[model samples]
Target: MSAERQLTVLSREWCHLCHDLIEALKPLQAEFGFGLQVVDVDADEALEARWNELVPVLLEGEVEICHHFLDEGAVRAHFQRIG
Candidate 1:
């Protein structure tokens, strides 16, 4: 799969929800064989501004998938669509 097919998680190191989302995505990443990129939103000014309160945002390229939680159904649907 291409990089665009990977899931990007915008998060902050101090956010518990961010950690939880990453943990939740582990099995899905394995099952779907998709790459998962975790980025600290606080590391970038723009990202931090846009996603500060919405840390743990899941994205497929520029498309927002979910925030503060892992939406398994949406994730599975994304895989289905990509495949």
Candidate 2:
């Protein structure tokens, strides 16, 4: 993976789904060697307002890869595309 490629998880500390998604990404992150960042939407009022309903959103830069769950296929495809 290129150092420039990163995946961001918009998460909430209290959300089980958010935790699940982050855990799910760990193996993929190790395999793909992409940077992972987890952000709490609740930390920012604007972020919370915009993504209140989508706590476990996955993003590559500003582009959303998936929401509410981890899509491993989409993530793999993204890596392939970038390569």
Candidate 3:
């Protein structure tokens, strides 16, 4: 298959929800063949301001799939649509 598509997670240190979301997405990444990128929002002022409250935001090429929690259904739908 082609190189996996990039999926982004906007998160910060000490965020359990962010960690949970990543853990949940690991299996989906394997099934759908996408790569995960974790960004520490606190590291960037703009990113921190924009996503501080929405720290576990899941994005597929800038289109948000879900936030704060792992919306598995929405993620699956996004992958299927891209496919």
Indicate which candidate wins on TM-score. 3
Worst 10 residues of 1 by lDDT: 1-10
Tens digits of lDDT, candidate 2, 10-83: 99989999999999999998898889899999899998998899779998878888889999999888888878
* lDDT tens per residue, model 3, 2-35: 3468999998789999999999998888887787
Candidate 3 achieves a global lDDT of 0.87
Which pairs clash (backbone N, Cα, C closer than 3 Å) in model 1? none
Predicted structure 2: clash tally: 0
Model 1, 1-83: lDDT tens digits are 44346889998888998999999998887787778899998889999888888778999888888898999999888777878
How would you order the candidates by lDDT, starting with the best? Answer: 2, 3, 1
Runs with alpha carbons beyond 4 Å of true place in candidate 3: none
Best by lDDT: 2
TM-score of each: 0.89, 0.91, 0.92
The whole-model lDDT of each prediction reads 0.86, 0.89, 0.87
Which has the higher TM-score value, candidate number 1 or candidate number 2?
2
